[model samples]
Target: MARSIKNPKKAKRKNKGSKKGDGSSSSNSVPSLPVKVWQPGVDKIEEGEELQCDPSAYNSLHAFHIGWPCLSFDVVRDSLGLIRTDFPHTVYCVAGTQAEKASWNSIGIFKISNISGKRRDLVPPKATDNESDMDSDSSDSDEDGEVQNGGSAAPVFQLRKVLHEGCVNRIRAMPQNPHISASWADTGHVQVWDFSSHLNALAESETEVSRGASTVSNQTPLVKFSGHKDEGYAIDWSPLVSGRLVSGDCKNSIHLWEPTSGTTWIIDTNPFLGHAASVEDLQWSPTEVDVFASCSVDGNIAVWDIRLGKAPAASIKAHNADVNVLSWNGLASCMLASGSDDGTFSIRDLRLLKDGDSVVAHFEYHKHPITSIEWSPHEASTLAVSSSDNQLTVWDLSLERDEEEEAEFKAKTREQVNAPSDLPPQLLFVHQGQKDLKELHWHSQIPGMLMSTAADGFNILMPSNIETALPSNDA
Candidate 1:
């Protein structure tokens, strides 16, 4: 296990303390104000007026930079069990970078630890009007305030890099063996690598180490395939099977990979042909071993059963514009989520697929293209979405608009948060710190923990209000 440490020198921290009021509008307790809401496209800002983040909306938030911008990344599952509610959490991740030059790109393996803080759960007493006097009279402040008040400790990061030939468009780690990973490069090649050495080095290192230009001699991929005529962004490793993989390309070609040996895979030449335009994304069904899903730029979603041959078993015209991403709900296997280039996302029930009426819910909240989407592994009705508009949103399908509750909430919070009535009631949280938000993933081991990558940097956060069931300690 990776050890936790104090604030790292290379890391820049932006941590805020907790405020008063519980996250409720009950009659007895002073009604807690709702988090201030800001929509990227819907809300307009006046000259010299900038948007500020509501610290009360976050339980624990931390940001770090990896020197280069990354378009896609995967959270590497660690030895930690599925239900982890402990503070000061540690996580491992693998990301491929889009460097300024092709030769500058590399595969980064990260060990981010000591992510401590829980602001949302704390309930301090309401500060009186004499708060200013209290601040002036306080002798112990600064670093002493954190230690005396029991604030969350800052996080630390350690990284290792592996040189790559071209810019990585997308990357994924095998669910069965996280050390074995795959990357799709701009050069129209898919390569697989083993990061066991890097993982071991990070695990054993006692201090933080950030290697930007470090390289090992003869560092080569375990296997490489150049069968795709065009570069692609769609790739997924099947969770049901150990080494079963599916990849699709811009030429509307899809291929399957089967593990031949421990570190080798064989991809068949005959590709699955079901779309007229570019294949945008691919996802393997959570429940079915032989079933998978694919979305295309032609605005169609196809369900493929490998046993049924190259043709898709069923297909549907999912969107008016290009469908960019797909995320299958692992808890509720019947639900499938798709994000489109038109900034709308819809959820469909696989069981109700008949005559093109399978859509159960649709939302057009995002004004820019939807860049990434994923269903939370911990909650059946929860999912997260990222868009080019530089916002990441969390939604709960289980929530519905309650007129009386909404009225009561608005009455109490009207003075604090002036949100538009048109905003969806199901929308739970909106995180807006990064620029050109590209992708986001929920940590399977830690409930409510989310990591997102964008043009600015990476954000690892846990919303204070999102409810997640943590297993009992005795269990």
Candidate 2:
């Protein structure tokens, strides 16, 4: 029942007539690129005739919850629950959640699948205990080559503490440290969980510290850098250097720390002075490790190159309102996307700058603030964005030119305002709930598949294509 306006001719006419000098009006006539549309065919059934389901649909339906606030997420190579490269199917996620009023949590891990294709059949892999069992059995053997194990081997692993009630605001994983690292708002601490260890002892130790414990000797934090005067809103580990991490706080300060060496570095050298309000999100570039990006409550996106000390590599006065989230496409580091409180999404090209980085493409698609944005790992041009307007938008940037060129093209197209519409039609709208959407994530292994979560506790998995077969009506 929902329809998008298709007014290419009008848009072109509007653009062509606009003054060439005004940058704002230049982007108004840019047309969206063409996308594949799934049409209902004769094979589609009308009533209860029992249609054969596509095997690919089953494979695309597997959705897993990675974390809570999930303010941010990422995927890595050869991760747990992920298949090998030869399989060509794996997805990793990093998400933030809160645990009651106690602490913030972040979870990062990888997922794998045996099948392939956009619509392939997916069967949950059977449980196997080949290597894990072998290691357990071998641990029980003494150094003398004699089996000293008797009663259940004393259960070598134990759960230290259970985090029952909290949510994670955002999470990130360092390629430098395969272990997961996340920032929690409730406890005001950056927690790192090691996957190799059976038990997470550091989290337990922090729990004790909050309870007035004097000594934290038994538990060790790889490094605890302290400069946040208040709750830290966002944190990211450096992909280029091991143990180097950066965090933004409520006080509007970004601090860089070395967790292993206990050394702290401050890069506040720019007159930019960072954000005017609290910082909400930050991300490091996938292609160049030294370059990073940050978004704040003041509706601005700034790219910082640590080598330059405090000033941003480029700053763009992006949104009209608060900028909530930002992400860099893994395939094209030059391209980045951001979501804002203005119910709009903006895509920028890092290379397009006569003065500073400028907006290349923009979409005013939502009725409320955009909550999250994520780039597909497989395709740099494809992006998934979620908004408080209760909808998720999947954008194809590959078909569109960067903003500068788009602006020039639109200026020329406006001359044909009275012509027929040439703009592409809307592909699809995920219209399950009327409630605001909180998060959206794409399957790492499968292209054109994504998962969305809402404040109402509803999580839905949607495929790019949905087809149903019907009985032949010709008879």
Per-residue lDDT of model 2, residues 1-475, tens digit only: 0011111010000100001111111111225622111211112223422211122222123222332323334443333433122222334343443322333332433232322322211222233688646534532422211122223221111112223123445555566555545444434555554443412233222121211112212334343434456565567777667756677866677776645442333333232357777777788887786778898887778788877878676677888888888888778887888888887888888888665646778887566788778887666666777776555555666453255754465465443222113322221223322134566665554445455544332233333232111111222
Q: Tell me the TM-score of each prediction against the true structure.
A: 0.86, 0.58
Largest TM-score belongs to which candidate? 1
Could you tell me the TM-score of candidate 2? Answer: 0.58
- Give the per-residue lDDT of model 1 (tens digit) for 114-231: 7775533323344676974553343122321111114434566888888878878899999999999999998999999999999888777756765554453347899899999988
Kindly report which residue pairs in candidate 1 clash with one another.
none
Candidate 1, position 179, lDDT: 92
The parts of candidate 2 lying over 4 Å away from their true place are 1-59, 62-96, 101-167, 198-221, 259-272, 355-357, 399-436, 443-453, 456-462, 465-475
Best by lDDT: 1
In terms of lDDT, model 2 sits at 0.47
Residue 196 alpha-carbon offset, candidate 2, angstroms: 2.4
- Global Cα RMSD, each model: 7.2, 17.6
